[model samples]
Target: MTSKIKGLKHIIYDLSRINEWWLISAGFVLFAFLPYTFMHHGRVLDIEMFRILFTDPAVYIALLIVFSAQIFLFASNDYFDRDVDALDPGKRVRNPVCDGRVTLAGVRALLIVTAIIPLIASLYFGLLAFLFSALAMFIFYYYTAPPLRFKNKVFLDVLSHGLFVNTFPYFFCLVALMDFTVGTVFLLFAIMMRSTMAQMLQEIRDYHIDSQVEKNTVVVLGQKRAIWVVFSVYIVLFTVTTCLMLSYELFGWGIPMYYSIILILAISYIPIFRKLLKAKDYNREIERLWMGQGRTNRWQVAQYFASFSIYFILVIFLIITGYS
Candidate 1:
């Protein structure tokens, strides 16, 4: 009984690592289902509609598939970059592969096991979902796998991260609705830009290790260039969001909504802007971002919270004002 209890405890601990506090649970709900819910925008917001969205077995299956893909990609990335991660002082505790907690064999087993259910779910969801799922899987694999580790490439890295992690799965969820609108396209582009910016920030944090490893990320171009690119990406993302809001034709609510969201982002970004302006040594600023309790991380997290809240509020407003 004692040995069995220990074994069970170990299993539970391992599962926790894979679960990631069930953020995937929240992500699939907010990201996958929320966009799908947009299809029912003009419909009455009530318990029945909520039930239809939440209670569907297909929805759960799709969530499982997307979650599996995310885990597989992360595990594979850890497996492939274990050496670099081992050298990265910042990532040691969080990286099981680098610390020898999760072996290559274990990672491979994880990858194989998680790939099965998504395929089954894809078949059930229909051809379009299946195709999107398959494409996402391909990108996820190539993003970290040898010979084609797209993450090591310059522009390709950000593009792959944006599409595989954000766009494709989003489309997989939204495809079933088949309600493609100009607004949908704009929103998708906005999401891609957002994802790219976040990915770029990560690349900045990993710059030294990546440089040692000969990985050619955008940061390799130099700190000043990378910083400028980050600024540019955010500007484009803001523009896209503005365009999306205009498409909704809710100037009264949408205009305020746009300025509010932008203001939140700007407030968060101010600290980083201060740091940048005062930072004479580019490397020092990068180190502060990566190693110190700098404003960049705080701002990034704030932006994440603000973005989710703004979108959630927008959905609620639409339901309250426009729903029949």
Candidate 2:
């Protein structure tokens, strides 16, 4: 009985290491459902848009494809970054492949399964969906693959990160709505800019391991300069978004909820900006306090809080405005 219990415990632990549960959960939230929910509320007054977005098989299939591609991309990153991740204090705790809880072969098999799902989803959707899905796949492949590996390059790393994290989500939302309005395009660009800023900051947390790996933008640019880059981009984004919000209000198209989201994002950036200002040095001390540890935690918390608040406020506004 004791041996059996131990065996069961081991099984459970191994299952946890697979981390598919977390990935699927995130995919469902970020890709599969959130966009549709946002559009359903934002464009609720337009019955035709609602019907096209919610009832269309193409949109659903596109979401499926996006979800699958994300999973594969994540798994591939783990596969290639296993060595670097093993050395990363932040990554070591949960890195399945490096911890020996998950095998390369297993991850490869999972990637194959993930890749196949998108292809099947594309078949059910339309040619447009298929083409978009292929583009996402290519981006993921180039991100990890050699020669043109954008992950190792400075500008390309940021661009690729923006594309996968921001562009893909925006595209997913637009495709769901089946209508590409100016408002939708602006929202997409805002999301992309925000994601780019966040990703640049993230490099600070992984600086040590990334430096050892001799790749990643933070390593190439050095810490102080990297932080400056992060700050500059976000500052620009904050300015542009603020102006857009003001314009939205001036045009009488602004919902209170949109303003609320803008305010929240603005507030979230204040501390980050302060950190950038106070950063006098980029050695281990600054890296430890700002980059190595605290900044990542703060940024992650702020990111989730801001994103959730935006979605929640929008939904509430839709309901209150009698759109839903």
Top candidate on lDDT is 1
Q: Judge candidate 2 at residue 142 and give its lDDT.
A: 74
Give each model a TM-score. 0.78, 0.73
Q: RMSD in angstroms, all models?
A: 4.5, 5.5
**Model 1 lDDT per residue over 1-324, tens place:** 987675444323442344432563456345556546635654445677777778778677767776776666666777777777788676765667676665667677777876676777788778887777777888878887889989888889988887666455556666654646554555556557767776776776567667777566565677567767877877676665565456445543233342335445544565675676457664556555433442234544555687768767875785667642
Compare the candidates by TM-score and give the number of the best one.
Answer: 1
lDDT of 2 at 306: 74
lDDT of 2 at 10: 35
Q: For residues 94-143, could you state the per-residue lDDT of candidate 2 as single tens digits?
A: 55667776666677777788778886677564567667767777777678
Name the lDDT of candidate 1. Answer: 0.63
Clashes of each: 0, 0
